[model samples]
Target: MKKGLKTLLIIIAVILVITLPIISSYNNLVSLEQKVDQSASNIDTNLQRRSDLIPNLVNTVKGYAAHEEEIFTDIAEARSKLAGATNVSEQADADSELSNALSRLLVVVEKYPDLKANENFIALSDELAGTENRIAIARQDYNKIATEYNTKRRKFPTTIIASIFNFEEKPLYKADQGATEVPKVDFAD
Candidate 1:
């Protein structure tokens, strides 16, 4: 009986020793996933901030360039798409669309000297430019966190734990295929 009890105790200890690392690894993966999520959220917040700024800018430009209906319509449509985007990749694409539309709108504004010199319009443009910078920084930070999470989750025993937890990879915020080309709103003429 004593020998049997000792064997049982040894078996329990071995099981715990083998399982503890797995449990710890699983917890670490969860933490990394949460970090990536938080980073993504931060980027979304900046995107929303920029989107919110668009209305005022659009309204100001509308007064100066009432005939530019197409640009306004495109901006509104892009904004709607951005608002309804369901995933990170969709949101990024919509964001780029909105940026292009807004760029076009700005180019149209350049046709009017008064609008270009308006203090309110200039302030809004500065704010929009600053928000764009913020979005870029947020995206960079999110990508870094996501890369770390993905790498950790795909390696060794952590991969098994990640699979068990269903922690899938995140989509990178990549530029569109034509991103290297000039934006459609070029007014170099």
Candidate 2:
């Protein structure tokens, strides 16, 4: 009986020694993935807030610059694309397009000093700016957490576990090409 008990105890210990690290790694990966998902949701929330504010901004600008039909159309189209975007890459591209369209609209506003000075426009602009800042911070947080998760998942024993569990890599958010360029505003127009 003593010898049989000893054998059973050894088997249990061996199983624990092998399984504990795998369990720990999987739990850690799950926690990090949840953080990444929450951060992505934060970005979407901020983007939605900005989208909600655009119509008010557009209407205020429209009141002053009725003839700027082309810019308004562009803004509307860009807004539609942004609203329909399904993933991070599509969101980035649509965001860049909306930003460029807004820049052109700003130039139009510049032509009408009164629009810039309007209280409604000023308030909406401030809200939009704050939301944009939130969006940037959210994107940064998402990338940081996602990078950490990816790194951990790709490491030694964890990599084996991650592969078995199908922990696919999360994509890092990248800015659209030419997003850094200062949109040229033709004052001549």
Candidate 3:
């Protein structure tokens, strides 16, 4: 009886020793993934805030530059694309398009000094700027957490566990092409 009890105890200890690290690793991956998801949501929230601010800004500018109907149409289309974007890449592209349109709108504003000086336009611009900063910070946080999760999932023992659990790699948010370029606004038109 003593020998049998000792064997059972040894088996239990071995099972725990084998399972504990796997459990710990899985829990850690789950936590990191949740953080990444939350950070991504934060980006979406800030983007929505900016989107909400755009209509007011557009209206304010429209009151002054009603003749610039083409730029306003471009802004509307870009805003719609951004609203319909399902993922990071699509959102980035749509965001770049919207930024380009806004740049042209700014040039139009330059032509109308009164719009730039409008109190409503100034307030909306400030709000949009703040939201852009929030989006940037959120993207940075998401990338950092995603990098950590990806690294952890790719490591030796964790890699094996990750594969078994289907812990797919998280994608980093990248800016769209031409996003860094200053959109040229032609005054000659």
Q: Which candidate is the best by lDDT?
A: 1
Q: Which run of 10 residues does model 2 get worst, by summed lDDT?
A: 180-189
lDDT of 1 by residue, 1-189 (tens): 699999999999999999998999988888888888998898889888988999999999999999999999999999999999999999998998998898789789889999999999999999999999999999999899899988998899888888887889987889878888974555576
Better of 1 and 2 by TM-score: 2
Model 1 weakest 10-residue run by lDDT: 180-189
For residues 1-189, write the lDDT of model 3, one tens digit per residue. 699999999999999999999999999989988998898888888888888888999999989988899999999999999999998778878888887788788788888887778899999888988888898899899899999999999998999989999999988988766657875656685
Error of 3 at 86 (Å): 1.7
Model 2 lDDT tens row, 32-116: 9899899889988988888889899999998988988999999899989999999878888898899889888877878888888
After best superposition, candidate 2 residue 186: deviation in angstroms? 6.0
The better candidate by lDDT, 2 or 3, is 2
Candidate that beats the other on TM-score, 2 or 3, i.e. the better one: 2
- Stretches of candidate 2 exceeding 4 Å from the true structure: 180-189
Local distance difference test values of all predictions, in order: 0.90, 0.89, 0.88
| Candidate topping TM-score | 2
Score candidate 1 by TM-score against the native. 0.92
Candidate order, TM-score descending:
2, 1, 3
RMSD of each candidate relative to the true structure:
2.0, 1.7, 2.1
